[model samples]
Target: MLNLNRNSHVPWISAFLLIISYSIANGVYLTIERVTYYPIFKSDFTSILLTIIAASFMTFYNYKRYVYLIPLSLLSFLLTSITPLILLLPIAYELRKISSIVGISLLITSSSMLSWVFLRLIANVNTYFSLPLMLITAGVPVLIPIVWFIGIFFLFMPNKKGNKDSISLNPLIPFILTLLVSLLPYLPYINPYKFPETVDFKYYYSWLLHPQFDGWFFYTRPFYLILLYLLSLIFKPYPVAFYEFVFLSVFYVYSGYKLASALDRSIASLAALLASVSPMLITFLYSGLEANLFSISLMFLSMYYLIKKEKITLAIILSLLSMLSHIYAWAQISTAIILYYVFRFMVSKIKPSKYEVIYLSSSLPFIFTGLLLIFMGIFPVPMSLANYNDLIYQIAVGSWGSSNMLLFFIITMLGNRFMKNLLGFIYAISVLGTLVIQPATNLIIDLPLFIPAAYALRYIRKDIAILLIINLVLWGIYMSINSVPKIH
Candidate 1:
């Protein structure tokens, strides 16, 4: 449907070539490492060869039908590294249509592969200047795939007339009403002592009640802890919990408002309504999980600035703050920021100005704090976490019961006809990647689903809103019935 010129295809072709170059380079390095340094694999070679043959056939079949080949190939890669060659199938397809959706998907896949490589490189490095080497090595894997994907996405994007009032919102009445309604479900479970008594509260509360700055504090969410500590100073435990609840709820509503405004006022109202009643958000609020609340709110706000305002400095600062609130937010916020800049640079030729640089530079203290936490062995590595299968199951059907919402969000996103549709696809793919690659922090994927769902509401507002209200009421009742016992 989009009008395009002959030269538009060049960028996709170039991206395909870049991906090929990286693949070849990685293949060579892996081969040399296996052959010269690592032990010679006799039996494993048979498995690897068989995997290659199987993956090649699968890739060919999927490519012929114009279906996505990366997921199966990615699964195979997990089992045997040789299957990474299947990545070529999707890249080859992108050369034909050059859809931003496809480009974002490839970006996710390549980024995952690069992150794996970086982790391996860091693990293997054992020298006097390993720290500097590790830092430098970290940038390469991220930058290469990022630039390639950004190029394809930007080059092929449709050149439409810009809407000057895109960022404007309608009256605040509807948003306020939505916020009030969203607070209704939590009203029944508002026992401050009981609400904050859930998991992780005790650990965080301990840090708040008795402040200790020296040595390595394994809990790196200092902002959250400090806020809780300040709240504790003025109020009893129950009131402190109540105030925290109100603060997070307001921020969540505000984020939805801003995000929706970027598209339209009606859409913004719908987004705020959804956020107020979202089962996942409500659950976290009831449980007093400041990290999850703050991270999701800040992530949403960061995306608003990046996409709507083109305020790179605010985006970066909020993103870093979100990362500080919870390490789990790093992947979600980072991916969104990267895509935002890629779109901005491509569509508007906008780059970060000196003011943006000055603002971002302000985050150095927080970055240093994170680095210190890492140095003191405060943060746990992926290997130290729960097994992948367990984490995957938890994400799929555990406390974060977002599987149904994720399914609905994906269906709505795919059905919508908008530029933001690509973003929905990106988030959907990231959700899958989070499940398979880094299941430890799976809930972060919920943040991106909001945008598409908000957009979809514009089409089927009445029907969807009715269904959402029914579901919200049922979920609220469920939460109230199964509420945690209050702490003495």
Candidate 2:
């Protein structure tokens, strides 16, 4: 049994020291790995001295507060070496019992680090596993965070009969906070040639120089290209990238706020923050992949209006715009529309409203375009040969990969039963589609997961929701650090 005091500083201090020790060990390991040739004393002495100091302070200050830290610190310093963060997970789990805030924070940090390390390990392993084993290995990182999150919820935030009044806060605060936190990790990478390595930018740049008006432009999203062209007029490439980054960030936060507002104002803010700090979203933003960001922002915004049954026209317009932004967006928006109507028919037992009809009808043009492409035999344009092993490797990375779709389905089914039956149907289909198709870049396809998650957050305690948000931020940070820059 451990101390379970929310107000106590002892557990917080212990957790902080554990993080510090892990950081020191990781820094030393990275230094050793980076240096081609390292002097023994320079590497060994520095790491050993720092590790001892960190471990000694941790032991002296609050050894009784968390006895597990003793072995964790020693093993982190001596055994795990480069992967000390994984050793802090048990400490985080224990801390949750004492202080939910510190406990969940450390839990997210450790879990995210473990995900990164595991993904790297999978990539390095030359041997292959059977499909089932590969699926399990890929799912480990994605599933661990969800499992731990559920464990924390049940352990600390047991559901009670009476519901507490939701907290009231101006939505702008979250929007601003999200913008600040979302910008922090990518601040250093902002420049005129920001993410110049991405091949997609070439198309935008070329479209800016010469406007294309032919029907052949179907493959290229005209609206996104036009926006890039306009931005290019006033700013250089880097500034254009920054402007798009800011634009997309604002919308991302706004979408979260809109979706969350359906349940509670405070929850809306937290959802916005979580969505803004999402690792998948952040990774795309930093890479200057504005097409997907724009598409996703519109998707969320449309979903918000669709859920509230307000401003149906605006939702329809936004849905269309999202479709025009990217082919991926088109697929996601189309799927969402089909799902929304099907869910309504099967679960709600109510006829579709006129507004819903309008929304469904609006998708026709995009659908027709897709069909026309296929009929003309111009769809699925041939590309360089794709390696199935590499595709499996990407899925195994657990960074918003295919495994997440399955996890999201489980989460949907467990969190809200009605929602599980409703959104769960859509999620199941999406996951199956992802498995069969396994598109090269599939993050945008996972947008549907956030809908059920937002509903789940509404029902949970506020503190628990905040814990989830913190976890999202930590996950985003890890992805940003480990992400490979796009090659042109």
- Which candidate number maximizes lDDT? 2
The TM-score of candidate 1 is: 0.52
Looking at model 2, residue 279 earns an lDDT score of 39
lDDT of 2 at 286: 37
lDDT of 2 by residue, 1-488 (tens): 33334435444555454444333333311111111111111233444444444444444545665445555555533553432344345445544333555545545544645554445444532121111211212223333333423422332233433324443456676566556644543444322234442334565566556667555454546677667767777786555643456667687778767765654455565556556555346445434566877776777778778767799889888887777776665665566567667776887787778877887778766777765674466655333444455554443332333232233333333343324333344444444344345454353334544444555555556675555544555444433333334223
Question: What lDDT does model 1 reach?
Answer: 0.46
Q: What is the lDDT of candidate 2?
A: 0.49
Error of 2 at 388 (Å): 9.3
Over 4 Å off in model 2, which ranges? 1-139, 142-170, 185-199, 210-218, 236-238, 263-266, 343-349, 371-377, 381-392, 395-426, 440-451, 454-468, 477-488
Flag regions of model 1 displaced more than 4 Å: 1-198, 214-219, 310-317, 339-378, 381-392, 400-407, 410-412, 415-429, 435-446, 472-477, 484-488
Rate residue 442 of model 2 by lDDT: 57
